[model samples]
Target: VLKGVVYISLSDNMLYKSGSYEMSDQAGETLNKIAKIIKDYSNYDVLIEGNTDNVPITSKNIRNNWDLSALRASSVVQTLQNKYGVDPKRLTAGGRGEYNPIADNSTEAGKIKNRRTQIIITPKLDQFMDLIGKAPEKS
Candidate 1:
């Protein structure tokens, strides 16, 4: 059996429009499949993280990559709760912006790869509390 958290990562291009945070229809379909999986494993909490390329973004709606990323993450969480019936308490949304890059941002291909979203499903740790018992005090 898996011991701890299981993370599911999805790219932003697959979920949203370029320079936008709205979830696309295709994203809905993909999220539906994910929702089914979450339903079966309802004991876990989900953390939706949004990441963006280093390219600067400026718009009336968005202040920067951070705002854009955060909104994207929030949008995913909202979709999971509103459309998929997932409990709101089990969801968290965070934006990493252009800071954490998985690829070289010098190339278009790399930038595309960097703009992404990650869904991390962490199993509740309460089940192991008994095993851990109490920690010894520091010296």
Candidate 2:
């Protein structure tokens, strides 16, 4: 469980080819696992968030690393809904892009690690309540 919500992380290596939204063959098993979990926990909602390195994209198809990241996230969402029969309403896709870097961009290894996507599974309960409950009350 994470952030008061059940989640499973799906990295880029296990997901797509470098700079592409296409799912890799290695991703099949991991994705299948998520699908199975979704089936088991039908009430849970899946939120797919994508991230990327500092390397800016300049391609016509990819305006910047952000677009690439979002494309990847969207692809995963589509796969889950289309292949696993997960309800479309139960899934969401978004991209943080390079705006939110997990590692230093100076090194190739760090960049690789930063260029990844994550899936956060959350229940329908109001998440904001967790924060409000944890706050320190003042007179």
Candidate 3:
């Protein structure tokens, strides 16, 4: 957890097969556990962010890392809503592609680290918005 937000990073290998957005059976089990936690925390919103290594990719369906990343995130979000019964309004899906690298992409280990899906859970914005509304304006 960081700054009141919980970050759960799942490696690409855990969620998908090589170069594909299709979630594995193991991914379903993992997501089932995550869904339980999400249900336990009703006031938090989930952000599914997908990241990829710097390696270029071209497949029958996926054109590039950006497309792959977005598709991966969307897959997770859809599963969470449709399969796990998470509220659709509480989820957001995004792709970082190769831009936001937590590790150097020059090494195999780094590339492995770069290929990940981050599930960021944060409290809803209602309290924050209320705080902002109550703040006094300066001249």
Best by TM-score: 3
Error of 1 at 76 (Å): 0.4
Write out the backbone clash pairs for model 3. Answer: none
Full candidate order by TM-score, most accurate first = 3, 1, 2
Give the per-residue lDDT of model 1 (tens digit) for 1-139: 2445567778887899878999887898889988887777788778899999999896788999999999999999999999999998989999999999999999999998899998888766784464246645569
Q: Rank the candidates by lDDT, best first.
A: 3, 1, 2
Using all chains and alpha carbons, the TM-scores for the candidates as numbered come to 0.87, 0.84, 0.90
Error of 2 at 88 (Å): 0.8
Tens-place lDDT digits, model 3, residues 38-125: 8887888999999999999879879889999999999999999999999999999999999999999999999999999999998789
Which residue runs does candidate 1 get wrong by more than 4 Å?
1-3, 128-139
- Tell me the spans in candidate 2 whose CA falls farther than 4 Å from its real position: 126-139
lDDT of each: 0.86, 0.82, 0.91
Best candidate (score: lDDT)? 3
Candidate 3's TM-score:
0.90
